[model samples]
Target: MPSRSFVVLAEQAQARHDGRVQFRQVLIDAVKPAVDLVYPPRCPLCGTAIAQQKGLCAPCWSELIIPGEPCCTTCQRPFPADYSEAAMVCGPCMADPPRHDGIAAGTLYNHASRALVLSFKHGRRIALSRMLAPLIIAQLPQLEGEWLVVPVPLHWSRLWYRGFNQAALLAEHIAKATGQTLLVDGLRRTRRTQPLGGLGRKGRERMLSGSIRLHPRKSDVMKAAQVILVDDVLTSGATSDACVKALKRGGAKTVKIACFSRVLDEARGQNTAMPETKTPEA
Candidate 1:
């Protein structure tokens, strides 16, 4: 018979090896079940099951209007039918050139895209960022250089109330996809502003003016790096412009806007006028 001490040592060794084997098996079992149950994630836009991962279903993907030729060079907004692509400036960009050098958007802010954005931003569908980020990255193939991505910041009070920043979530995914550095603290909203959805172009511009500021320490990084400001939506381009202005003031060499959607002015059915701003009272 084995000595008692030798048997105890042998038993301890076997137990340790068994524990490691059991742990590995548990992990494999947990992951295997999930893998078997996996279907392509559903489209946030149409709720149709998508093939592969982080993508829209083929039909919905085909239906997506990737903004193409004849867009505004500076803003990436679709230009009027008669506008020339070589013009380099749309009427709005010429009239009031944004502080940013250019813009890139994943899709037109039309009915389908609007549904998706609203679901992700307000419905707490945080997983939608996984699909949205890849689409945005697909549109920005030329995105290279010493780039820093900064999300449009939400006020601390609003973030606390909402429990997340949709833009920040989107930015995180983009940073992960592109291997670009995310400078989350680069921009901030000093005051809470009313949602700009129903505001007229001018009203939206006024509301966002001077609302964003850059951190003092990141001025050196801003001076040295190109910046891409990420946001969930673009309406009247006011928020992006405000962010660009602040980044430029902090010495950013160039600033560009990248958003998931852009609201079209002409799409409002009969409600063409600006609605009253409903800011929360302090």
Candidate 2:
């Protein structure tokens, strides 16, 4: 017969093994429904049901106004019909050059695209990134050299409030699709600045200046590789410019900006030109 101590040890070991088995079973059961649901998913923009996984229905996908020919290479702005160059730089870019080498965006941030961006940023519709990633990947041929993917960092306070960084999520998806390395911690917003929305161009630039800091450990990676800054939206470009400046200062060989949407110049009407009246400070 076994001694008392030996019996206790055996019982404890058996209990641990049983617990592990039960935990694994629970995990399997929990994940099965999620996998099934993803196969026939709902559209992130319109909430319409989709038959395929990780995509909008065919009609909604077709309706998206993807950026086409005659766009500014630096800013990705649509140019007038008279402009015929494949790499047309916008007037602002020509006048005041950005630190980054180039900009690539998936779509114009018009009413249709805004719906998807708002859902992802405000409504926590993270699944929308699946649809957007491929669009970003299509622009990868335009990128050159050994590139690292860096998402625009959210201030820690805002990150805590939202429980997630939408840009990071989008960057992760893009990284996965393109097989590019993602350096999420390369840049961080050390001091929370005023909201860029509603601010005039100068105010927006001022708010972003000196707001971002590059991570110390990522210095080596930044030095060795080109970088692609990722974000969900591009409004005045001030925020991205700040990130680009920080990355370059940290020794990034080159930097480019990519986003799901870019705000059109014409869309910045008089009513929306004013910055928000007030925002919480960090």
| Number of the top-ranking candidate, with TM-score as the measure | 2
Q: Tell me how many clashing residue pairs each candidate has.
A: 0, 3
Query: How big is the positional error of residue 183 in model 2, measured in Å on the Cα after superposition?
Result: 0.5
The C-alpha lDDT values of all candidates are 0.76, 0.77
Among the numbered candidates, top lDDT falls to: 2
Question: Which portions of model 2 show Cα errors greater than 4 Å?
Answer: 1-40, 270-282
Worst 10 residues of 2 by lDDT: 273-282
lDDT of candidate model 1 versus the reference:
0.76
lDDT string, candidate 2, 69-117, tens digits: 6778776777877887666688887898878787788887666677777
Pairs with steric clashes in candidate 1: none
